[model samples]
Target: MLEWLAGGAEAFIGVFNEGGKVFIAFVTGILPTLIVLLTAVYAIIELVGEQRVHKVARYAAGNVFTRYTILPLLAVFFLTNPMAYTFGVFLEEKHKPAFYDSAVSFVHPITGLFPHANPGELFVWLGVAAGITKLVENGTAPFSLAKLALFYFVVGLVVILLKGIVTEWITKIIARREGVTL
Candidate 1:
């Protein structure tokens, strides 16, 4: 069956009103936390000094654990996805591709626990969790959004770590044998 539309100025007005509600919700629910988080990241970066960050990046580039895990994790969380790629500039030619693999893979996984990490892709987390949330509200499921977020966060980290390691190893082998086509 189909429903009828208001079919006039009223329908247009109604759509705008609903859009306004979403904008209001976003401003109230996510904006403050995002502002504070971004501010803190910038403040910490400023206080720590770019020179120190570069030194750490150079140091981190040599070790697999630091190279793939700490560096990527920090860069992604510190600068957030696209901007995080800037950190790769500090790495050697061989390490840059591997570091990028780790950094790029982390953007979505991080949104669960830190929505601000990929705020533009918040729907990735929320869309999946929405069904469970409805079930919980209806008392049909035992899960909550906090639990789900935490679960996703932990799993995401694990996946990122594994992906980073494997990709780095593969990249090394490929570059050595095939001239960095990978």
Candidate 2:
């Protein structure tokens, strides 16, 4: 029993050692890129100024169409990973954005689908959609870029719209019940 336990422990340690190397390599590869991206984002924010950022947020959140559709789409497509943190800071400094605006901006498929702001994610998604289309069509047809784009657009739109609407409604309700103005 002692030998068996020792063997198992040795195996586990060996596995962990190899896994740790891989983890370290991944972090080393990703860290520089992340630092550069974050630095650029921060520098741009500073150059743009707090007031301009607040104005953009207010404009984006001015209406349901802009709030639910345009804002989230732009956040995901353009801002990528930094949108949430940037907006959080802006909200803290300006206190102008609504809960829904921040919520929708943060809760998008950008990071999951488009890590590092790479457009290659769209191609990957298109490939997946093509595979599904092939399965649906029994390998009779290829999926078009237009179809893939439409599918991506519709899915993104629905997610942002639902999240924004629900967040706004719930926030308003909670604030009203607590006798607080949002």
Best by TM-score: 1
Off by over 4 Å in 1: 1-17, 179-182
TM-score of 2: 0.55
Q: Compute each candidate's TM-score over C-alphas.
A: 0.80, 0.55
Candidate 1 has an lDDT of 0.78
Which segments of model 2 are wrong by more than 4 Å? 69-108, 113-157, 170-182
12-81: candidate 1 lDDT, tens digit per residue: 8989999898679778977788888888878888999978877887887778777877787778788886
Local distance difference test, each candidate = 0.78, 0.57
Q: In angstroms, how far off is 64's CA in candidate 2?
A: 1.3
